[model samples]
Target: MDGGERYQEFDPPKALRPWVRKVWTYACPSPSRTIQRIAPDGCPELILDLGDPYEEADADGVFHLQPPALFAGQMTRPIAIRPVGPVELVALRFHPDGARDWLGRSLRTATDQRLNMTDRLRDLSPPAGDPEAQARQMIDWMAGQRRDDWSIDPLVRTEVEAIHADQPSPPRDASARRALQRRFLDRVGIAPRTLRSVIRFRRVFDHAMAEEAEGWLSAGLDAGYFDQPQLAREFRRFLGCTATEWAREQVELARAIASQSYKPGGPEPG
Candidate 1:
């Protein structure tokens, strides 16, 4: 399966650009479909995961679970098989500057999900006991995510502005960028751009698909592809398929996720 889930877009505060990475929530078919990703460092991740699946792999196969984060030195290009069951996950991709010390361990690795300063994620969660409540709770949770606290005070807010626009993928302020980036790399511990690129790239398709276009060429170009071949190259690079094959799956997955039973406010009816 490829591109089967309903992925939501999110932007991080610009001021936190050096420290904060990308953040988002995704809903997909359960028992997630497999995705083969080609990372920047020549590392190929054959990922088959559920919500917030983290890194672990071998020849026998792969295993995924939430927390117990890992160190991803740089951002990687992603390609995924379609998901098979319903899934909801909140994700934060680390920027190079946002690098943290304990990213290589599980959520319980350093101090547990709470004090894990590797990514130094903050949570101002309100109480929620059930599914529906959780959804509503996350809506608000995401709201606070907008405030990137410069310091990790638990309920802290950073002064960074969110940069969700596709244009500045390459930053203009090299010096200042490097300074804030130093804060992430030297202190916190992992790559925030790694988090930004993957999450941003994923959302690119999520938004592209909603337009109900005919092919991947058009979609990629709209996102500023140099040419159809360029788009195809990236498609194959990330997804292990040509543009046509990937487009075919995108269409199928969209339909699968949008069957008549799909409802936004209610449970994904089976």
Candidate 2:
């Protein structure tokens, strides 16, 4: 079922801009609602459920209620979430290596899992009216904890940037490439090659969804995929379903965040 949802996002403070993409909040009054498919898009998020805790289902069919506050790592595959009641949630979507700065830990543990972070945010107040103000409050809290010694590695940043660029070829030197992979795995919680594929796949999906494509072939070529079959293969590999099947799910939150431009914010909650 489609939930009439309200989403709002804020530009992070200058000090945290390099690591933070945007902080956003989503609210929907429909209770017992399920979002069946969340396609992987390479972004990592710290989420806080201000209204109701949701249940998450993994690939194996195992279901568990997610924490009210948690850090969700890079999901290379589809995951499902169902809220037990009407929802009000806030989240911070981090840059590729941004979690390292905020979590003070390796992202490897967080990948494909909702690692509980509720304890860390217990003292902070939830955003009451203004989503932007709350986002800044969260940013300030994270910035206050920044360590002088911590920063995203220069090499890692360069490699991630290359993955997002038009051409994503890795280093020519085998040894150099291996070293880059190690650093990427350590900091980003996934192998360099895997990250590259996810990034590439997401570009196509985003393009396809944003523009009203006539069919997958047009989207595939536009996204730089080798062929329509290649795009289909990647879609099944990452999302465990055909692109057409996924389209039927109508994942509102995912689509809202993925839009090229944010829809205007809704009226503040009472």
TM-score of each: 0.41, 0.87
Predicted candidate 1 versus true structure: per-residue lDDT over 67-110, tens digit per residue: 42223333234323333345554444433223232243221122
Which stretch of 10 consecutive residues in model 1 shows the poorest summed lDDT?
261-270
In order, candidate lDDTs are: 0.36, 0.71
Deviating ranges (above 4 Å) for candidate 1: 1-75, 79-130, 136-163, 167-174, 184-214, 247-270
Q: After superposition, how far is residue 192 of candidate 2 from its true place, in Å?
A: 1.8
Please, what are the lDDT tens digits per residue for candidate 2 over residues 133-215? Answer: 67777778777876777676878877677766746665469888888777887778888677777877776665445333456
RMSD of each: 10.5, 5.3
